[model samples]
Structure formats: structure tokens, C-alpha cells
Target chain A: MPTIVVDVMPKAELLDPQGKAVTGALNRLSSSRESGSGISEVRIGKRFELTVEGPVTEELRERVREIAADILSNSVIEDVVNIDFGDDAS
Target chain B: MTFRIGVVTFPGSLDERDAQRAIRLAGAEAVELWHGEHDLKGVDAIVLPGGFSYGDYLRAGAIAAVSPIMSEVIDAAGTGMPVLGICNGFQMLVEAHLLPGGLIRNAHQQFIRRDQGLRVENADTAWTNEFATGDEIIIPLKNGDGGYIADAETLKRVEGEGRVAFRYTGLNPNGSLNDIAGLTNERGNVVGLMPHPEHAVEAGFGPDTEVAMRSGVDGLRFFTSALRALAAV
Candidate 1:
């Protein structure tokens, strides 16, 4: 079986309010440290793990990529970072 | 014959009853439709009322955008059936590709609820024919993900074509680009907005008016406009 992973993130040009809020909270938490945690940023996104029962053939890879780009992420606002198959199951 | 308008109720829909009531008050027969239903019960128009459908699991309106009945709505909208999406319903419209642009979280990262002022930008749509262009109205607005966004080209196209149906007047409640509050499709049959027009159909239970609080009935025009549209057809 081949396991596939898809990561989705807001387009860089668009604002990520949730990610910014999380980063702001982190900055506040680390402000009092003698040496700040040095955690300068956080960019939040979604990840999906899909498993296939058979080998990850070229056709399967194409189909998975299509789904990841067209359905898993909205092209207008979000983008798919990558689609990778585990075990190099090509 | 009474015009029949369908109010779709998804699993988390919170305003189907109010939409149906508004339709009835507009002298139309209100029909309740379901997300799972394939048929629209021969409705003359459709209203996708607001709510956090599917609990905003993946994204606001993302799951419900692909619901079974949406295919039918899509087909009808293509044939010029009037369809109005409010709030979360507007999110679904964008998610389903029934409308342009996308809605993201508010800039302040907080859920906002308040009476909002809107300027009617294009009154030729099936849902806005009752209001003259440039009319200002008060309606209730409440949402978390309500900021409207689009690429520069798309924004220019919508604006140049006069597809913007309404715009925020007094204040940009959610930081929507260009102060847009609502929009219509090219044919003007499908409209979507962040405000809750269904909540303002009746006096004493809607947004505040200049004379008294909760006396606004400006939202009634949307339903009445639908009635006029159906009558003309």
C-alpha cells in the first residue's frame, strides 16, 4: 500500500489571519524569556494523508495530483504545497 | 398563482425558517428544501440561508458546497433561476464556483455581529430589482469568515462589469476588499451577500432604523424583488 500526503496553504499573496494570530500569541508568550524563543514566525496550513492499496503508478500519481490541486485546495486563495507518496512507491 | 420559493436547509442551516417566512410575507409560497434532496420541488427561486454548515470542518461552506442538491441549484442558476446566498451561504456560493472571489477570516480574527449599512450598487439583479441603485439599507451581519477577497484582475472585471450588488457604507465591517458586501452573477440571476436580509424583513425584529431600534424593513426588498422577478418571467 502506498500512502500519499497533500499539504495545503493559503497563497502567499493572500492574508492568513489565523496563522498571523497564532504567531502573535507565540510572540507574546516568548516576550518575557531571558532569550526569546527565536520563534519568529508560523504559517498554518492543512495536510491530508491518503492511502492506496496498490502500487503508486504514474496514472495514480496524476489523478492524485489533480485532486490535490483542484479539490483539496482552492486555486483562488489556497495552493497545494506538495503531493508525496510514502516508500517511494512509484 | 402563488410564486413558490425554496429555502434550502442543510444540516447546520440556522435561517431557513426566517427565509421561508420572508418569502411568505412577500406573497410567495415558501417551500422547504433539503440538502440531500435531488429535486427542488419545482420552486420558482431558491434561497441558501446562512449557517456554519458541516460545522466549518474543512472550511466554511466547503463541505456543503458539494452537497447533492447543489448540482440542481447549479443547473437552475445557469438557466436563470433566481438564487440568493446569504452569509455562510455566500461562502458556499464562492466555494461551489457559483460566484467569484473567496471569503477568509475577518482581519481582526473575531466573529462579528452587528447591524450593518449597505449601499445598493446594482439594482438590476433578480434579488435587488425592488431597490433603486444607490439606495442605502440596514441589515444584520454576523460571521467569522466574512472578508471578501479576489485577485486584482477578477476584482477589476467584477467592478467594471457592475457585478457588485451592494457595498458597505458606514464602515468596512470585515475588511472586505473594495468594501463589497454583495455581488451578482453576470446574468444577474444569482446573488450572494454577507448580510442577513432574511433577518430584516419584519419590523421590531430587524436592524435598527433611524426612528426606532429594530424597526428596519429594508431587507424586505430582496424578497419582494424576487417576487417581481418571478412575475416578470
Candidate 2:
């Protein structure tokens, strides 16, 4: 079995409040330490692992790409950042 | 003939009953439809009520947008069927590409519930023919992810075309761009908004008015507007 990894993230121009809240929490924790961590910003996203049987092929990759772009992510406010096929790369 | 409006109930839907009740109060037949079904049951109009469908998984309304019944919804909307989406239903509309733009997490990062004020921007749509442009109304709004966003070109085009159905009057609750609260499609048959209009249809259960508490029936016109639109056809 091969696994196709799809990563989706909010658009860069759009504001991400969830990511901002996480960044704020990290900054507050780092401020208490003697050596402050250099954290500028953070953006949270989603990763989907799709398991498929059989060998990876160009046709299958294209099909997965279509699903990633259309079903897995909405192009209006989010982008499909990466699609990775591990070990079974064609 | 009595107008029959369908209210779709998806898995985890919380406001389908309220929507059906609102339609009935407007002197129309309220038809119950399911997300997993393939039929619209010969409904004259459709209402997508608010709720956390699919538990808001994989983004709100994302999964439910592609459910079995949505294919029929998309087709019906294409042929000029009147459809209204409220709150989470609005999310599904945008997710299904029935309307433009997208809704994201609120800028304040908190779930907000309020009696929101809205100014009618376009009164010619199927769902808003009862209103006049610039008419202000109050409706109850509740949501966690309701911030509306779009690219520059898309925003400009939507605004230039007079597709904006409503605008937040007093305050932008979720930091929606341009204070846009609702929108209508090009054909003026489909509309989506982030407020719960069904909650405001009953005089005793709606937002407070100047005369009495929870005595506002502004939402009743939304259902009547659909009836009016259907009668003219």
C-alpha cells in the first residue's frame, strides 16, 4: 500500500486567527525563559493521508492531484501546498 | 397554489425544524429533505438551515457540500430554483461554489452570538424582493467561523455587479470584508447569509424591537419574498 500526503494551508493574504493565537501562546511561554526563542509567526494547516492499493503511476498521481485540488482543499481561501507520495514515488 | 419550500437537514443539522417552522408561519408548505437523498420532492423553493453538518469536519460545510443531495441542489439552482442558505448553510453554499468567496475563522477567534443589524443592499433578489434597498433589520447571528474573504479582483467584481444582498450596518461581527453580510447569485435565485433569519421569523422569539421584546418579525418577509417570486413565475 502507498500513501499520498496532501497538505492544505490558508491563503497567505488571508488572516488566520487560529495560527495567530498559537503564536501568541508560544511567545508568552518563550518570554519566561532566559534565552528567548526566535518565533516570528505561525500558521496552522491540515494534512491528509490517502492510502491506496497498487503501484503509483502517472494516471493515479493525476487523479490524486485532482482530488487534492477539488475535494481536499478549497482554492478560494486555502491552497494545496504540497502533495507527496512516499516510498512509492513514480 | 400553496408554495412548497424544502428545508434540507444534513447530519448534525440543528436548525432544520426552525426553518421549516418559519416557512409554515409564512403560509407555505414546508417540505423536509435529507442530505443523503437524491430527490427534492418537487419543492418550489429550498432553504438550507444552519448547523454544524458533519461536525464541522474538514472545514465547516466542506464535506456536506459534496453529499449525495447537493448534486441535485446544484442542478436545481442552475435552473433558477430559489434557494437560501443561512449561517452554516452559507458555508456549504460557498464550499459547493454555488456562490462566491469563502468563510474563514473569525478574526476575533471566538464564537460570537448576537442580534446583528443588517442593511439590505439589493432588494431585487428572489429572497429579498419584499425589502427595499437600505432597509435595516435585526437578525440573530451565531457562529464560530464566519469571516468572509475573497481575492481583490473577485471582491471588486462582486461589488460592482450589485450582487451584495446585505451589509452589516452597525458593526462587522466577524470582520467580513467590506462589511458584507449576505450575497445573491447572478441569476438572483440563490442567496446566502451568515445570520439566522429563521430564528427571527416569529414575533415572540425574534430579536427585540423598539415596541417589545422579541417582537420583531423581519425574517417573515424572507419566506414571503420567495413566495412572491414564485407567484410571479
**What TM-score do all the candidates reach, one by one?**
0.96, 0.97
Q: Worst lDDT window (10 residues) for model 2 chain A?
A: A81-90
Backbone clash pairs for candidate 1 read none
- iRMS values in order, in angstroms? 0.8, 0.6
- Residue B149, model 2: lDDT of 92
Clashes in candidate 1: how many?
0
Off by over 4 Å in 1: A34-37, A87-90
Query: Best candidate per TM-score, number?
Result: 2
Q: Report the lDDT tens digits of candidate 1 across residue range B143-204.
A: 99999999999999999999999999987988899999999999999999999999998888
Please state the error at residue A50 of candidate 2 in Å: 0.7
Tens digit per residue, CA lDDT, model 2, B1-233:
99999999999899999999999999999999999999999999999999999999998999999999999999999999999999999999999999999999999999999888999999999999999999999989899989999999999999999999999888789999999989999999999999988999987899988889998889999999999999999
